[model samples]
Target: MAHVVTAFLRNRGRILLTRRSDAVGTYSGKWAGVSGYVEGDPNDAEDDARRELEEEVGVTEATLANTAQPMHITDGEREWTVHAFMFDVNHRDIAPNEELAAVEWVHAPVICERDTVPELWPTYRRVAPTLETVQTDDAHGSAWVSLRALEVLRDAASDAESWEVLVSFGRSLRDARPSMAAVTNRVNRVLADAAGDTEALCQRAAAEIDAAAEADDVASAEAAQLLRTEGYDHVATLSRSGTVRAALEDAGPSVLVAESRPGLEGVTVAESLAKKGLETTLTTDAALPGLVADGAVDAVLVGADAVLSSGDVVNKVGSYPVALAAARADVPVFAVCARDKIRGDDTVVGEEGGALYDGDLPITVSNPLFELVPSDLADGVVTEEGRLDSDGVERVAAEHAELARWDESTSSGADAGGDG
Candidate 1:
């Protein structure tokens, strides 16, 4: 029920505008950004954003961030909420889409000084604040988000219909109540800027922690500080999250085991569990049926790359079938994750990472880092707050959405991916 749009601005003080090629839809003849009234389309905002951006300015997912301004206005009896975004890109050859006579790069402030579309001006003013970009990236080389991945995962999350994203978000917030807001704020701010590298991320985290500390937000600030420190250690190979030990501690007994894919990640899982004093039975992809049919296991725990709003998990290639097997056997399948992996209510696990796949280009394929496992198969989700149900997840998420403050340095969603 809202109208959202995006304006891609370049750092050289130029804003990209598109003129009306056809005059049938809203504001046909006027110049606009990769702008459009949001279809209010569930689970497809990223896709819509990407499509519009490319159509208007010929850019790809690796060029924008999840930062947009909400412009609320009323045109006669019509009311709209357009989220105009500021996207920066280097200057390149421009091929104006027939709608406009010409395209030029002008200072952002000049948009007001120049004689341009009347309606477009107001949109710029309101959108500018939202586009102020909480974090300023000096590097400004290149930036991007998993536009397509976000689109596909959001669709799967909604279509599953068995789980709602709010469940997990609420769970995170509730459990981490004191510090959630600050954490999210910091993380969102980092994301807004073009700071994707490891150093920038840590710097962002440290800044957030300092902010929290100043605000006297001890719990979250401390968490923020921890992540910044730990995250830096991880990237620099300075510290580790206990490679095999953690999995074994969580798996309990190896009987309820399923291997992850890509690099047979399950080896990490099985080895970790074995070290942790569990009866681990490591099996291959085919052995799933025999084990489940024979009533061999009581539960399953798998790692994930991302989680959708509808409680569908995007895990490794083998994860989906494991979930299916667990469901058929009436056994509970749980997912173990740390606080950094949590993105709002849904994990954004498989989304916003990269082109689904990138190994062999030219023949580019979508290499989603995970698969969707419906909530029905998910017996519970384990996080720092202990095991949470779908509803418990709801509460935790609600509790933390406002408080789960993350800085730029953490929650990179860098560890895993799923099958496309």
Candidate 2:
């Protein structure tokens, strides 16, 4: 039996696929991820996977996202056990070794059409986010969940046999993250615009995924502009928000990050910003509001999981306190997100987390994943379209509500059919 490792390098919602060259010993002229024989013991699979990524594609700093159970394949009297890894790379600079002839970065679903080695798509599936992953993910913000929702729809579109099936699956993705308006709005837009056409739906979904990512980028730009305009040089934030990170990076502001409890996502954010050369301070969640009130933080910038029609923001649990502190200190508080994050209604679903204490005591502990920040606390909302006033927020909320009409229409049709 032979052990090998396949590394899928992902960037900006796409994975890297390389065509094997004639110089390769096995599966020559076939599409594959970065693959090579695992040197030494099978326990060395992760190290070998990293080695293969650097050796084959010159990716020395890619972050390992996931690893899957080993898959066993048979080829003409030889058994092969393949270890799969998915890595997140920051750039697309590829210098393929002699083993690869060509390289392309494409959507994961596109791999279904390529002539690849044994069970390539299946192996990719093992590492990709499923409905469950999206539902249970606590470390990432809503934007990340929304992107994963799109990935789920993309995978379902590849396998769905009919428009009805695709719509059903899209609805499932929409509901996967109940508190995330971006996920619901994006999935709803794709379903409604598709208009019962599977091919068109898949195409639109792919485009929408790109558009969603671009929306976040543009929103971050808008926030960065606001930071520049207001001369808010020191920003305080909690939790891990990709949008917030991008905005801070672009605006070049020193940051005060709260170590959000139960997850400590802010530690990751602090480390990331520090690596980017931004002066970042990591503090306990309890200390952040005090710092903001003490005039150490010039502004409070947070990412919203859902922006309600009332202009209230649903975000990580610690956001409300930060916003309150900023408000008391006369510091401007901004909630940054794409327009799709604005929900049609004021409905807030607060998800409860498991108990952090493992003791045998019978005391009840409460841990909510998110909380609501009233509209008055936020000075402005920075979106892709720029800063939104109350009227602008209402308009965007109405647009999101309109996008969700497809669900109501579908339900009505189902009810009518049942009555018949």
Candidate 3:
């Protein structure tokens, strides 16, 4: 069997699809991701995928997001095995070689309608997040997961037979990450605005995905401004928050990131910030709070999994101690996130994780994925709408509550139709 690699380049919520030139050996004039024949052992497929991306689209630098198992396809007497890879790129500029007739960055669902090579949609599905992926994801923050949930709905809506089925899909996405208020709030907004229409729902889901991304951008900008205006030269954070990274990039603050245990997401964050030319320091989770108490940190900025109506922030485990240390040091602690993360209630749902310790000793090991930092511990909350006061948080929470009512409204409509 012949082995080949296909790399999907993603930027700003779209995938790059290239139209193969007629001069290519096979699948000429068909839309496909950056692809090429794999050289050497299949175990080294990722290197071949990167090499193809550089040759096909002039993309020399990109973060590998995912890889799928090899898919076998039979075209005539030739058997071919396709290896799929996905990359998240920072820029959209592309220099298409002669092998590509044209290139366009489009939503993944659009691939379904396009005349493409064999199993292109299936290959994309392998890299994209499913409901299960969203639920089990530990690498990304809630804001990131919420946007991915919208993408999941967008793809599902394309195949849904009726409005009822679409609603069911949206409901499943809304409940996929219970601790992620942004996931529930954003999905609810799309469902409520669509109002039981499939086409409208699809359109709204796409629009909301863009809006949600923009919201994070705006919130990051707001936080950056806060950092500059307040003269917070040194900031400390825990875990990996995309918005937090963006804000630090914009503000150019010296950063100390705690190595969020088990996952060590903060190591990734610290490396990313350092690459962006920011002064960065990596510390163990246990050392971070002490560093804050030593006045090494001017401010503590974190991304929220949920901002409760009571103004408390639910974030990755180990945030509370940092907040407490910041409070003791009189350093301002800010929770940064889009307004969609604000929940209508103060109830915090905790996710239990698998035991980290496996031994013959019968001691229980508790691994909670999240924890709550009381509202009093936070100095302020920064959002796209600016610094939100307690009243503003409550107002956003009320809006969220109203958006959540779409479920009741849809269910009632279905019951009324049955009665009719």
Question: Which candidate ranks first by TM-score, i.e. highest?
Answer: 2
C-alpha-based local distance difference test score of model 2: 0.89
Candidate 3 Cα lDDT to native: 0.91
Writing each residue's lDDT as its tens digit, candidate 1 over 183-267 gives: 3433344333313343343333334333432322222233223333333111000001121124335323344444533345456
Off by over 4 Å in 1: 1-186, 189-247, 250-252, 256-259, 345-367, 398-420
Q: Give the TM-score of candidate 2.
A: 0.95
Model 2 residue 47 distance off true place after TM-score fit, in angstroms: 1.3
RMSD of each predicted structure? 19.7, 1.7, 2.0
Encode model 3's per-residue lDDT on 1-420: one tens digit a residue.
999998999876778999999879998989999999999789899999999998988999999888989999886888889999999997899999999999998888889889898889988888877888788888788988898899888878877899888888788889999999999998999899988778788788888888998999999999999999999999999998899899999999999999998888888999999999999999999999999999998999999999999999999889999999999999999999999999988889989877887889888888899999999999889999999999999999999999999999889989999999
Q: lDDT of each prediction vs. the true structure?
A: 0.44, 0.89, 0.91
- By TM-score, the better pick of 1 and 2 is 2
User: What is the full ranking by lDDT, best candidate first?
Assistant: 3, 2, 1
4 Cα displacement, candidate 2 (Å) = 1.6
Candidate 3, residue 301: how far the Cα is off, in Å: 0.8
lDDT of 2 by residue, 1-420 (tens): 899998999876778999999999988999999999999789879999998888888889988778988999886887889999999887899889999999999888888889998889888988987888788888788998888788778777877898777777788889988899999999999898887778777777788888998999999999999999999999999888899899999999999999988788889999999999999999999999999999998889999999999999999888888888888899999999999999988899888888778999897888898899999999888999999999999999999989999988888887898999
TM-score of 1: 0.37
